[model samples]
Target: MSTNERLRRRIPQQDRSRAMVERIIAAGHTVLLENGYEGASTNRIARTAGISPGSVYQYFPDKDAIVAEVVDRWTDALHARISCVFAEALDGPADQLSVRVVMGELLDALGENPRLLRVLIEELPRSPDSRLAAFERRMDDLLTVWLRFHLRGHDAPPVGAIAWMLVRTVENVAISYVLDRPPVERDIVADELTAMVTAYLRDISLP
Candidate 1:
């Protein structure tokens, strides 16, 4: 089933019901982070929310459903933050500074909740339709457009290919830094990533 279908439950139509659903999702987030995916249960989430297990069932069919909601909300917030950064970067020259700004924001966003990010990256089963996959594809599209416009007068590889490489490279590096907790400082990593990406784009766009 699609993610939307799997997450779809009895949609709460009233304000109170919507608020209750939000509370359950918040509780599910906490439980998932505290207990990991396997340890998380409907009863545990219900307890976390200070509600009966039956009440949780009213909004979500199962533990997976509740966790899906939690993951969706978290990824949505991350997407918004990154998208804003991308939008702003597009307005300026695609220089080292713009690249650094984007990388810095990415690190900050992914580092906001390391435990939850770890759970999502390591514990959750990913599908092509997953939120993370979708986020990458969106980023790819955005970067492709930016590259095409910026390299209009220069010879360059297919923007699609460059975008694909760049999106994955930057994302995996940021994820590793956040999850692995390397001894290197974040500013240094951001500087290195910016220099690498800027140089690659410049080389590829040369006549």
Candidate 2:
């Protein structure tokens, strides 16, 4: 009957709701990957997840909500991967190779999840607020913090500007690869792009 006990009692319900949300998101992802954007439907996703269609509705009012959560999950995972790669460089000196290393890691990670990325790109415009806008904001915030953290001793480009440029550049590269329109070999393309950007920054940041 105590207040604290009542609050503790709600924790399990919240946890269960979160778990259901995750399951629905996962189901939506699989459906999207298999069916592409137009083919994916709430009923199919629910069937794929072994849940009733109404149950999915309980967690998500519509398919767009599911798509948003799927995109958010993908973004979180991508950030975690990049964060682990950058954590070592964040505390110490910055170097061209470190930049290359981060870029390479991002390219590699995206390569591994190309299908999911494709689904994301396809679903972006469909989002109510549009995933592209949200993604742009998230990428800028994360990259600015990480870049400023690492570019300690270096007189680097303005963190916010560089963050936007980096996100835009990498996103274009990723999209090209996703669409099979990359100008050259995808593996070498990211490295070359990183090298170009690194050299430019080094030149501009020079005293």
Candidate 3:
């Protein structure tokens, strides 16, 4: 249930073993979304995986163990996608970066696995601890580094504080927008967020 569990987690070494693990994870994802957490059991996952219930337990201690692996895989991919955007956007003059450019990359990241994201948002928190925590921490780590140097000695609010706000605000908007019905086009939302960020980065006076 806790993130630490993943550190010593079991992994399939042989190709056949790896394939079985993948199948089990895929089944877990499907069952978790379809049946909800309460209904997702090792036995059900094994049935969906075309494997035996003992086989499921051979790999994962319990259902949460399976869910933990699923979240780990997803969060790793999402982190890579977002980090790529940050590298490109922050490589040049950070000031030249528009909200459109930043937001587009971020939206693209969210576009990768909306369903898994929904599961993380809706279900994972029920556990005492979650892999989603790692994902959020990774975002904070990457964004904090970017913010500290992006402005290059320019005057601004505390890098830590504003970076926290930036990540939280953008995450809420991105996730909510994806889950909401018929929200405005991503570009318009990006523009609005860009405007807000630009203004907030300035002194008390706004022109």
Candidate 4:
């Protein structure tokens, strides 16, 4: 493990310890959503987690470490939620409808935790070396691979570029749709994003 990874937090070895870590991370996330990053302190998280401050400190060195854990969990949940989309898209026709379904589901996942998502979107870029940043970069690479297979055909637009663009589309839309005043309906935003990506892919992809 890298020094940074080790420094972020501890890995629970037993099932019981693992559950405690999950609870602590989940509580940390709740603090973030309810109080924002500035208000999410280790003591507050420990209180919310129903654990001793020493227990929280034993696992996570600081607030950033807890935040990193939350981001990692969120991204892992995202990966789980979308795994089927990739599988279905790659197994058969990877067309616009598949794209539409995936985009819609992706937004729905974001809707599940708008406040925390907002904090992550706003605060993550400040530290390029953060684990959250690494998770996002890995997402771009994964999306690139997904696009390569999903859009495989003659004259396919560069998957790398398109993947980057698609990732940005989700980020922008999530930030707006999740945080904007009277946020746009999830379906509406999803439909528009699906249409835009579909159009771009169709224009370059062979029939």
Give the candidate number with the greatest lDDT.
Answer: 1
Compute the lDDT of residue 49 as modeled in candidate 3: 91
User: For model 1, how does the per-residue alpha-carbon lDDT over 139-174 read when each residue is reduced to its tens digit?
Assistant: 998998888888888865689998999999999999
The local lDDT score (0 to 100) that residue 168 gets in candidate 1 is: 95
lDDT of 4 by residue, 1-207 (tens): 664865567778999999899899899888988888887899999999998999998788888788877887786777667666655664555467887787877777777877777887775545766544565576577767766776665666678877777777666775577777454676788788878877776665666
Q: Give me candidate 3's TM-score against the actual structure.
A: 0.83
Indicate the worst ten consecutive residues by lDDT in candidate 1: 1-10
Worst 10 residues of 4 by lDDT: 85-94
Which parts of model 1 have CA positions greater than 4 angstroms off?
Answer: 1-4
Backbone N/Cα/C clashes per model: 0, 0, 0, 0
Per-candidate local distance difference test: 0.92, 0.70, 0.73, 0.75
Give the C-alpha miss distance for residue 187 in model 1, angstroms: 0.4
Please list the residue runs of candidate 3 whose C-alpha ends up more than 4 Å from where it truly belongs after superposition.
1-9, 95-98, 126-131, 150-156, 203-207
Screening candidate 3 with a backbone cut-off below 3 angstroms (N, C-alpha, C), the clashing residue pairs are none
State the lDDT of candidate 2 residue by residue for 1-207, as single tens digits: 542332131112587787876788899989888887778888999998898999887767667667666777777777677767766544444466776776777777777777778877755464434445565666677667866765677766688988788778876776667567556766587677778767765665555
Better of 1 and 3 by lDDT: 1
Q: Per-residue lDDT of 1-207 in model 3, one digit per residue for the tens?
A: 545664344678999888888899999988987887777888999999998998887788788788877777877777777767766765654342555587777777776667767777876664434455565666677666766666555655477776777778888898887766355887777777777766665432223
Give candidate 2 regions above 4 Å deviation: 1-22, 90-94, 126-159, 181-187
Best by TM-score: 1
